[model samples]
Target: MTAAHAPISAEPRRADFERWRRRSRLIRTLRVVLPAVIVLIFLGLIGSVAWSTFNAQPRAAQVGDEPIRLISPRFVGRDDKGRAFVLTAESAIRDRLDYQRVILKKPALVLDENGPDQMRINGADGVFHEQSGKLELSNGVRMEDAENAFTTAASLFDTKTGEVVGSGPIQGAGGLGEIQAQSYGVYGKGETMVFKGGVRTRLETKK
Candidate 1:
């Protein structure tokens, strides 16, 4: 009975020792591997942030603050008498010093377009005053309507009141005749033409 009991007890003791050894070996391997994996993941995160920061520097440096430019600009408005007018230009450049002032190239203006008395004016260069609704045209300005056409050196036109005035030499040809004068004013939607300053007229005979 003692010999049988010894073998049974020894077998159970051996099995318990084997189980403890396997568990200890597994614990040791996990302890070393877990710390190594955690260090690798932390390094990967740091490297990603460093790469992103390096690539962003050039794009940040390339931005600029510059003045605005316009192409083929158009402005439309109504006059005091509810007459429509349109101001168009080949190109317009905004003034850097004054935001409301625009420098126009090949500026063209059309007034009372939908009405029976329409007027058109063209200039080589112009300056628009936004607040006053004033247009200053220069460099061979030409103005025309249904009955008359005139060329002047310079003119100031008020878009709101539909009033035009020029103080320089002007030459004109129209239904009445050809006239050359030093100054002129057009009012009442061009129903009236007043010329001043050394006025000369050549009337055409209507046969």
Candidate 2:
């Protein structure tokens, strides 16, 4: 007869099966809980980002009364006689106190545009009175045309009449030759020109 076989115990196998069931239950619970926790965290982050994005917008600024500013300004209108004229400036500003007055920098005025008697006057600084059609030219006033060129310390120009009057010293060169005077007046496209107060002329003739 063979040696008596040792008996196998079922307790060890049963314990192993019980441990496997417990582990399977724990794994299923964790699978569901982990994804739910991750989705909740993701949703919280999305909500926070959306809230911050909506709150980060710009606000409107304050407005002011003088809102107009210009560069290379140009003005075109008819004179009193219905002739055309133009005024240009490197910069211009309307007077806050007087709307009719305009301050000009490096101002240039062209009279009788494209006509036989075209004239141009310019200055470093000027004040144009729009209603009266008077321009106060100062700081190196200069006047020019086809035949004449004049310069003075200061002058007054009437755009309507095409007249330039200067009480300060005026010097110029023209068909009559180089002339100097304490004061001068030129009317309407130089149809008439007069000089007074220590007037002097030099004949510049080229042979």
Candidate 3:
């Protein structure tokens, strides 16, 4: 014969059931609320980034009447025939009247660096017109190529037409000899030059 089994208490089992129910409810609530909190944080970060971008100012907008300064400003472009040209300035300032124009200090221009008509120009100061493709140089302008050298008080360059014209007196020296004129002009990408207005030339004779 087997001994009688003790009766199991229902109270303990009921308590265990209640505790399991509470734990399950807490896990479900966290599953829903945790994702919501994460989404809100992500949206806040995105909004902050957008606000900062909208309030930022551009480089050009910051310029004022005090003259924007640039160091070693350079411009590179091609002519009508696809010939490369370069313009560089030690320093540059934006024009007060027109924002599209720039004033360059100690500017240098190079045209067709590897071509037969390669030329280099230097000037104390220059004005560059962006829309018109015009460049004006002053304060003792000088130019040189493989065969000739020129000096002028002022000069103008037209990038569109590849022409360089003088505004004041000019002096030149080449294989032929010394030349002086009231005005001068260069065309054909520095292959041809013309001197005008009271021209004086002295050609050297071979001994």
The numbered model that scores best in TM-score is 1
For each candidate, C-alpha RMSD in Å? 8.7, 9.5, 10.8
What's the lDDT of the predicted structure labeled candidate 1? Answer: 0.91
Please give the clash total of every predicted structure, in order.
0, 0, 0
What are the runs in model 3 whose C-alpha is more than 4 Å off? Answer: 1-63
- As a TM-score, model 1 comes out at 0.68
Q: What TM-score, computed on C-alpha atoms, does each candidate reach?
A: 0.68, 0.65, 0.67
User: lDDT: which candidate is best?
Assistant: 1
Q: Any residue pairs clashing in model 1, and if so which?
A: none
- lDDT string for model 1 (1-207, tens) is 455543446888899999999999999999999999999999999999998988877666543323467899999998897889999999998777788899999999999886787999999999999889999999999999989999999999999999999999999898889999999999987888899999999999999
By lDDT, highest first, what's the ranking? 1, 3, 2
Q: Tens digits of per-residue lDDT for model 2 on 1-207?
A: 889988999999999999999999999999999999999999999999987777653221223346355688898877666667899999888886788898999999888878877888999999889899898989999998888999999889888777889899999898879999999998755768899999999998877
**Candidate 2, clashing residue pairs?**
none
Candidate 2 — number of clashing residue pairs?
0
What are the per-residue Cα lDDT tens digits for candidate 3 across 1-207?
999999999999999999999999999999999999999999999999988777664534555456778899998887775677899999999877788899999999988888877888889999999888888999989989898998999999887777899859999897689999999999986778899999999999978
